[model samples]
Target chain A: MEKTGADGFDGFVTARWSALFHLARLLCGGDRHRAEDLLQEALVKLWFAWPKVADEAPEAYVRKIMGRAAARSARRRWWGERPVDRLPELAQTGDMSAAVAERSRLETALAQLTPRQRAAVVLRYYQDLSEKQVAAVLGVPVGTARSHASRGVARLRQILADVIDPVG
Target chain B: MDHFEQELARMMRDSQEYIPFASEQRERLREGVRARRRLRAATVAGGSVLLVAGLTAGLFLLPKGPAVDRPQGPLTRPGTSSSSSPAPSTSSPAVSPTQSHAPGTPTGTGTTGGSSPPSTFPSGSVDPTTFPPNPPATTATAPATSTVAQGTRTARPPVSSPPAGSHSSG
Candidate 1:
């Protein structure tokens, strides 16, 4: 029974890791390491709750955990800093393509918004969740969730105006 | 949704690059679960210990009924019941002076002075006329009479002594 549960959990995490990581990235406003940390933290909690939520929606559980953690971490900014023996790799401009440039611009714009705004925008637009669903996940009122998404979209539009044509 | 919103959603979807769940991450997750489990166990164990300790301390600190109910000091001892003994004087100040002066003088009212003679009647029967008109103090020294009188006087209230004055006058 234990082995089957473990296998089920592993298989689910392995299958959904990429999608969950992406959501975590967006929720964290494009901080790759922070997104990885957030995803890992949510997954650990999911391991404990797997028995209850496994037959239902484990992905939704993970998404809720990540969203709430991302929102809460805004007050505790120390998680962004870490003692590292080696410096991180900088973005290479040598092999830069339009897609990579666009991705970078998008991430840069996302990073400009607060954690809550970024999470709301990502959940509403990317995950295709309604404002009420976003509010439930973030533990906020629907009006607040809608406000966060609208304000986030407004900010993103201002930042990505030059790249994304307004005519389309 | 507007065109910009559509474009924004498209861009968000396109930005996702697939990342496989690696062994390193799996190991880290297992470690986190184990660490949390150990922390929970320790917290429960420590809390139980503290609760038991608090209850035990409360029990030990409680006052004992038997110890408190037992009378204190030699003054309360039965050996000091003799009329001549000064211990009863210190213990019961009200009865002591009457016992001491009862053998020498006929103190008036006999309320205080007559207290010692009533205990001498072991049969619980005493004729009021047996009390001398002028003095009940003469009978105060008789050991059998004085002991019985003192015992009775200590047990019964002084109001019972008024009958002695009534019969003494008759």
Candidate 2:
């Protein structure tokens, strides 16, 4: 019985590792090292809780844990001290340069958001979760989730407006 | 999804292109789980040792406080029949040392003052009709001293006899 359970847990870990790591990277604001640590911590917790989690959607369970862990790590560390990635110069007007500039501008703006706001935005837009679903994952009220997502997107648009398009 | 939302999804996909998720991380995660379990087991063992030590210390320290301080046996010990009486005074064990000693010292002085008979006498008036039904000062203070000093002293006359047992035992 125990061996089968272990095998199941191992299989789940192997299958979900990449997708969860990708989520973790976005949640960690594209910091590969921090994302690796965050995903590893989430996986460790998932392994220990396999018995309880086996009955539920393991991906959602791990995502919720990762979201909370990322939030907690953000609180403890001075991530705000790290400067934003430099935005491309406004005068470089080539088509290819413009798209790369917009992407970098969007990333820099996303990195500026508070961890909760960023997580809510990523889960709501990137993962295609409803405000209610985002709330469940973030352990917040639906209204709070909606507000975080709206405010995060508004901030991102404001920051990236010149790079993406001058129009709203 | 709105245009901004679609852009966010695209941006996230673009950002995560470089992070390589490896199979070895599963073993790393399992190692972490084992370390956590060991830490939790150590914590439980340490806490249990501390609790057992605390209880053992409490057991030894408790008896050293003087056996007399234990709540007096039963209200039955007083041989008093009034059931309602014990309620107010049952709290007397803790109150005994301070309350009893305060009144006891003055009575001791009064007894030695050659006014022993006046102090010793329970009711000063010969007419029982005029006397209050309860002479609580003597009754209450008497048991308090007796119970409080039981380990070190003998019982004494209830009225105004000085608690020589308390003084001598001290």
Candidate 1 residues A55-158, lDDT tens each?
99999999999999987886895755332333234377578876766777787788777778888999999999999999999999999999999999998888
The window of 10 residues in a row where model 1 chain B has the poorest summed lDDT is: B104-113
Q: Candidate 2 — which pairs collide?
A: none
Give lDDT tens digits, candidate 1, residues B34-96.
987898899999999999999998788666756788877644333223344333322243544
lDDT against true structure, model 1: 0.74
lDDT of 2 by residue, B1-170 (tens): 66656766776666544334465765677788899899989999999999999999999898879886777764432222433342323222333343333445423322232222333322222111222332344346686444355311111233223345457777
Indicate which candidate wins on DockQ. 1
Off by over 4 Å in 2: A78-106, A162-168, B14-23, B63-170
lDDT of 1 at A106: 82
The alpha-carbon lDDT assigned to residue B81 of candidate 2 equals: 40
Score every model by TM-score. 0.68, 0.62
lDDT of 2 by residue, A13-69 (tens): 777777788788768766667878888888787777888888788899889998877
